[model samples]
Target chain A: MSAQPVPLVPVLAVVGIGLIGGSFAAALRRAGQVGRVLGVGRRQASLDRALALGLIDEVVDLEQAARRADLILLATPVGAMRAALEALGPHLRPEALVTDAGSTKADVAAIARAALGERLRQFLPGHPIAGSEMTGPEAAHPALYHGRKVVLTPLAETPVRARDWLTRVWEACGAHVLLMDAERHDRVLASISHLPHLLAAAYMAQVSREGDADLRLSLAGTGFRDFTRIAAGSAEVWRDIFLSNRESVLDELAAFERVLGELRKTLEDPDPRALEAFLEQAALARRLWDGRSAMT
Target chain B: MSAQPVPLVPVLAVVGIGLIGGSFAAALRRAGQVGRVLGVGRRQASLDRALALGLIDEVVDLEQAARRADLILLATPVGAMRAALEALGPHLRPEALVTDAGSTKADVAAIARAALGERLRQFLPGHPIAGSEMTGPEAAHPALYHGRKVVLTPLAETPVRARDWLTRVWEACGAHVLLMDAERHDRVLASISHLPHLLAAAYMAQVSREGDADLRLSLAGTGFRDFTRIAAGSAEVWRDIFLSNRESVLDELAAFERVLGELRKTLEDPDPRALEAFLEQAALARRLWDGRSAMT
Candidate 1:
């Protein structure tokens, strides 16, 4: 179904004003689709920075912001999302549309379902597949979501109005929106995004534990740098992601391990042809994927 | 001991005129430190391209080129080094200083010792820690090795004159030369370079074999791109590397598996604190290493 036309939101409340939240607020403000944006977070300094950068018009308490908002965007970590929803629950206007920008959709959906109770229809779970190896308000930019995919997992109980408004808002921010079930969204992301992050972290940890790690680090060049760049992401953030999406992440890890096992066996047996074939398959697949990505 | 001052070499022969060899020829030519560079390869078209690009002055056969050279550079794959060295053996001039740009030094060293026989003293196994996912003479650039590390794994029987001349030549090309034993060089590279390449290949292979691979690939972002960039390298070249350095690469793979096993257990057990700590350690280590690399 096509998204219905929605007018400018009177007031938008963005909780957890870090990279994702700040970027959303900035994008909305730049598009002139939000009359005023209110930033809410535990960190006063972060909220103040967001306001100063014009990402938001003002910093306000969560409950107060919820009361004033025509729409509320939950942009906290999935782990912190439950508490934010609970605190905003009582203060939320009866007609307010609620949405989130979390990585793991299933967990966030469950949390929202439990906390929002009767207001579940207002909650739309979204994940903007956009970011850098960066965080905080300083790292936020208006174009962060431009030309990126933003998947929305709207519950069966979700109102059509809420889903359509959220879609229109993300589209205004230059995001290409796709709709999917929470479970499928989580599984797909686990395979592509989460698994790669954990692998990079594990590789880095392995190298750091080496006897001659210092020497190895010295010899690391551009290849190593690119491969492990995601390992340098915030620990607190990734930890939440790994745990929240543990099941799917574990499945992907198991699949990767199996492939690695096959490769290890080939290496041990010294099968030149098999090894070459395996590497060739991977190289060809990656090149094809890269070509398609560049085109899109 | 210090490197001795060496005059311009009258003739230099570069076998396997691909990325590494072509770049070396171009750099030496740009520095005006060599009178003439002869390109030797199985592909006449590649050698002709090198000559046309001014990377070499002429194209010749291995034996013919070896006989006319004051210096010989074996710049082929590690697997091909043995055959190349054997072919150049009978035609080598007595005073010719020989070096290589192989990825795995231990394998190259063993091959050199076996094929060069009495002339092993003139052979220095070298690896220029510089390359791109691209290969071939067309990808060659004079500045490819500038400010890059060039590791030379000199054998015990290697003559000081051979080592000195090779070191000076690489220095003229703007590479910082470091000396180490072949075993140590291989082990260090296995930990840093080879291990990461195998990991990237494994990850790419895993994703490619997935049921919904196209979907997963569409969801991939910059993180996946950077992580798998090396996986797009020449399959023939990397396969040889993996096989030639099988022992060391397997050791690294085992170590990585152990770390991954621990991470998996932690994930299964649902330990948020433990998981956070693990991610934190890796992030800290990667950041510190990146800081040092940037400074250098």
Candidate 2:
């Protein structure tokens, strides 16, 4: 018996070939599942850089890229997704299986549905929960997606053919694929990702203002540094994320405030039992949680 | 040309041969600085393990260990420092240089001063701002102190000879030594170290308490894991630290609450400019701060 032949090579058009886009191109190219990787970006410099770096075979016009490619990947920021969808409307082939690398799914899926109509049957909004603190094509690497989880949010009208194709694309790139609804995805991410960024920034500000300014900084050691490392992310990108997920973020903030309040009471009065319980649960959860799911 | 001979090696006694103590012994052994490394602990099992692992040359009685050793390193919890000082006082040699790896400096320094009178001159209260989340003698590695900062809190009555000797010991163990006052060290660490742990514990508690607990955990990634790693530390140890540094920790907590309140407002209403500034400052601070100074 012989192994069955592989499916037809899909032509992939990657928009905004930065870290996510560039890494996807590298993974797809290495897997040999995609043919003729075409990249589309606003900056000619980045497009030239992507081509030079072998992240893509060529840079092509948006309409031409959309029409010719069998699959189109929207790898831009969530804020830019709407505009890109609008630009892609004129030439997106109805059968092309469209996907994205946006962090938030609900908004992107809505935008794709409104802009692409019947062609939206091919759309699968995705959030590949993988990345580094560093950004841009220079930071892109082939192994960046290995063992990572890629979340896909498919519409009710999405064809089984498109869903299977999208799953194959992600699996070929060495990602663990999972399905989620758009609203639930945003809510869960708000509690885990967006809220943590805000809290890191808030705590850092507190450290600068509340502590004996000179002494606090002087005494600050590794514990503080490790805790606040995430505060080192891009301001514009974080600001947009926080804004886009505002309601869920606010809900998490309020929940956190209640927890903090309880801790404050325990602190003021110094209850050993209460404090121990707080740390015990956290330790259990952290130990049991698999950190590999966050490969991006 | 004649070169001055290197200083004679000190017979170093490491009390409570756990992670910090075991690492200190191993580091000294690796650097070929100790004439003999003597291990002293309340538990016979730990002493045997430490000797077998070559963290020390011999396991000795606490009294005999203090009497024979030239350098005494009390690498135990802050809660145990006072008791250790009392036990070692009667047997400590007159010219012995004593130091500790306690997180809280003021209380330990005070306890040592009140217990040992003139013998205090031989004691150089020190805190090696270094450790990992892991524990036990087995977790100890010779490279634990490399490129880290070790803060020493020497009283005015502390002899210059003892301070200088202890500084050499830390330098031999691969640390950059710095002078700090006890009160100042407590306040500074309260903000940077203690507050962050409390905040993380609180954050984890809030997220874990949600109705859809599994959903919240499902979305947690690297940022969440890194942010909450320290929250998984020993509850007994952290509880003691927070309580010992109560005043400073309380003050820092209040400051943190104020900033968190402001951030909550920003999130609730969505102020991009204000949020941007908050993130920019945090990012700038984190990028500029030297990570080597974080060892505490």
Candidate 3:
């Protein structure tokens, strides 16, 4: 879970300096691993706020960032990765390695392959699993990634120097870093992350679409509150995740539907033992997950 | 959210003194609204724990409770209501009103009708909306019901004095008491509570059944943790709820499946706008709910 110390980078660039990117910049600054931080994004107002908050040393264009930064971290929504990578591709100085904090890996990898062309080996796909209901520059904090897992998906041909350096950077930010391939990372995340978000949003939509939505919401207890917490995630971000990780998410959804269908059939006759056994499996599994999670 | 003071009951009995029942006893004791509490349940070990935890003054049989108590709270699972009511029927003296903390109500009312006979009017069906991932007597606390909603479903034939007295007691226990009918309560709860629990359990079952479930779970973050928390609820308890409230829960499930089906089709085309719009609606509604819920 720990990584050896690495030298500070001369200049670091962050694309889409929202919670993830902004927090990364702050954490790296706190760890004294970056000499200067450059922010790049479409939103000038947000970038201004990040600059004012000292999350970044300066706000710069993508071209300037690619030319100057020793490391470039893409933290934009998954949907924007293509354009951002393409923009960063042309002006990249040699040894200017790029990494991303995207939620999914396979699509980002594919996009990087096509967009970065010969520089694809320099593009490391990663997902930093941080929890936040809020977004934007204001929500970013140094401790955002503390004790969190950061999965790095690097192609086989990527330079070990670059991979090991990024791993140390994340570890310096108080993260537990793990190496994974793009396909494996995507498959793991599709089950644990993507499908749950989809289900939560879908459930919320169903409740809100009800004739007595306000009344139903009024009667909602703590269970409803917790179950739908993830449904409040940024819509644009989730849309890109679901679309980019389409096949895996759909497969997970179908698997969930099968279980749901079985439970539905159990409810038809509603055999007491059958229902209890079905519920027991889930309850036991969920309880075990919590127990192990607490240990970790 | 505040209620006027109500005088203490001389003696009260709580059936199945787990989280809900034991917590109610503790809250009533803290409010100085109960002179003594008698616990009744099938598990002697649990009853002993309740006695040791000071959740109950003494352990007693249903007959002893029926004869000695001024009020009785049937806080057992909804499936056990009929058996409890049938047991309490013969020995119940006049004015010894009964209430419940069962999650589902319409079915409880029907069961009360059959089991309690002439004493049906004495039963005041209720549900106290409290949040907890843990259960048993050890989980009981005086503040468990503070600022929480306790919905009371009283029959028209039930005496006004009984309804008013129970409402005052719940308020004294620091709950916001709301008046509702059995059918309406069931429908509302089915939509919010029951459906969410079912979906969570189904999602958990699906994930656990996967070939690489351990790996997927190891990568689970905060979102998955929150979304699946309710799935860890007591299997026996949830089974009873799903069975007792089958019709309403099934209705809610069908409604959810309709929205889910539309989402499935949208995922098929992977249309950006449609997917974004769908997620946007859910995100907006969920955010609004949190804002209002915070105020309440």
Candidate 4:
């Protein structure tokens, strides 16, 4: 497989032309891995902006783009996946490969199963673990996904050829592709990605609602700034994610609350040894992770 | 007061020569504002390290150092403040100015009042809003407090001369000094610094205790890194902080729990508009804070 030459995608349709979609189109165009990149979105102004920025070669309707394309990249929010799949279902080419950049994979897989039916074999569910606080076509950059992890959760019905092709494409855009079960992907993401986001949001909401919020914010420094950075992400995008992966997110939240309660008890009772031990364990784990991540 | 010329201390003693104490000594030395810097700590090895690093001119016992010094800086943890003050109280020079670099001011003020009695008038409680994950004598740098905020929570019994002298000293080290009530300082810190630290520790405890912790940590990226970075802080240090300001921390913890419960409800009920509104408020607040903080 490594020795085989990968063929260029004759035509690529990128739905939702925002940060993820725009970055993907820009990267592929920069690599010259696609013949023509067609951007599809509900907003004509956004599509026009993406075209003007040279992120896409043309703007086309979902049906027309899907009918002419050899590949379709669904980069919309998780809530829009079902409708997007439905719109492309009738005109989707038999040989076209479909993939997505949604945060939640299980829901995307389920939506693909319901909407694509037999065409599900050609669909590969993926999520690139790269983003910024900024969104839209203007925020798009060719190096956004460079040196990032792009996870693929292929359905049981998905073809080996389709998965291999999608892996090659993501590699061309400078991402390392890893394959995992959809359920496992969602659970892993809930612990690392979804949980941190919710915790930051909760912290921001708490601080902002305080009686001395202005004073508190004025005193907040670098630590507060970095910790709440993700809480400033796209609200519409994150809300859709929270609802889409509700069960996993709730499980993680409960785990976090239980630990918080334990910490509160330690603080209230003033157990120096116990509190030190708990904090030491956490600090050790974080340091170990930091050391290992730097190497990898 | 602003027109007054700041007097140079003939001899200065810095108790507990860790990051805060070491940095203070180094910055004063760099500014050429002190005659001789005396380092005080239980550990001779740490004092030797500070002396070798040129952070202090010599090592001396706390009582002897306090008796000979024109100024004293207590840079130990809040838990150690009472014992530190008690040791210095009997031998402290009558004309000496004293201050502390504790994170929580109310407890430190109470400790000083109880320990120093008549000497409390010379003790001005302060907290420098500057630190790194790094600690100890080796981590000390001359520019550590440059462009930072140093908050002073002076007691009603504190002498105006002592407060003014301490403010001038901090300003000489390139810090902006602000004065507030001790109770207000604890509350504001609880909302910003203390609360964020607890949340990060809790999140880290939850994730590290999971059965698939290795996998979860491996998948963790920049967001997770930034969110949990403070969790890697000194265990003994934070444990002391949490216990020192327990009431204010508990109040902030309860507030965070309430907001988190609201977010969980929105997730469970699947209200797009409600979820978006909550997230939008948080995002807007963070962005606004970021903009204002950058300007300041």
Where does model 3 sit among the CAPRI classes? high
Candidate 1 lDDT by residue in tens digits, A151-270: 999999988878888899999898999999999889989988899999999999999998889988988899999999999999998998998899999989989989988888889988
Better of 1 and 2 by DockQ: 1
In model 4, what are the clashing residue pairs, if there are any? Answer: none
Put down candidate 3 lDDT per residue, B221-277, tens digits, no spaces: 889999999999889989988988999999999999999988888898878899999
Mind giving the per-residue lDDT tens digits that candidate 4 earns over A1-296?
Answer: 24434447868999989889999988887787877899999998999999999989898998898789999999888888899899898888889988999999999999999998888887899999998867899999989988888999988998888899899999989998889998888888999998899989889988988777988888888889878988988898888788888899998988888998998888888788888888898889889999998886
Question: Interface RMSD, all models, one decimal each?
Answer: 0.7, 1.6, 0.8, 0.9
lDDT of 2 by residue, A100-187 (tens): 9888888888888888877677778999989898777888888788878889988888888788878888888898888878888898
| Regions of model 4 farther than 4 Å from truth | A1-8, A29-32, A42-53, B1-7, B30-32, B43-45
Q: Candidate 1 residues B188-289, lDDT tens each?
A: 899899999998999999999988898889888898899999999889989888888889999988899899888888899998888999999999999999
For residue B126, what is the lDDT in candidate 4? 92
- Per lDDT, the best of the predicted structures is 3
Global lDDT of model 1: 0.88
The digit string of per-residue lDDT tens for model 2 on B185-213 reads 88878877888998888888888888987
Evaluate all candidate structures by whole-model CA lDDT and list the values in order.
Answer: 0.88, 0.82, 0.89, 0.88
What candidate 2 gets wrong by more than 4 Å, as runs, is: A1-9, A117-119, A209-219, A290-296, B1-9, B30-32, B290-296
RMSD of 1: 3.5
Deviation (Å) of B235 in candidate 3: 1.1
- Full candidate order by TM-score, most accurate first: 1, 3, 4, 2
How well does candidate 4 score on lDDT at residue B155? 88
In model 2, state the lDDT of residue B247.
Answer: 85
Candidate 4 docking class: medium
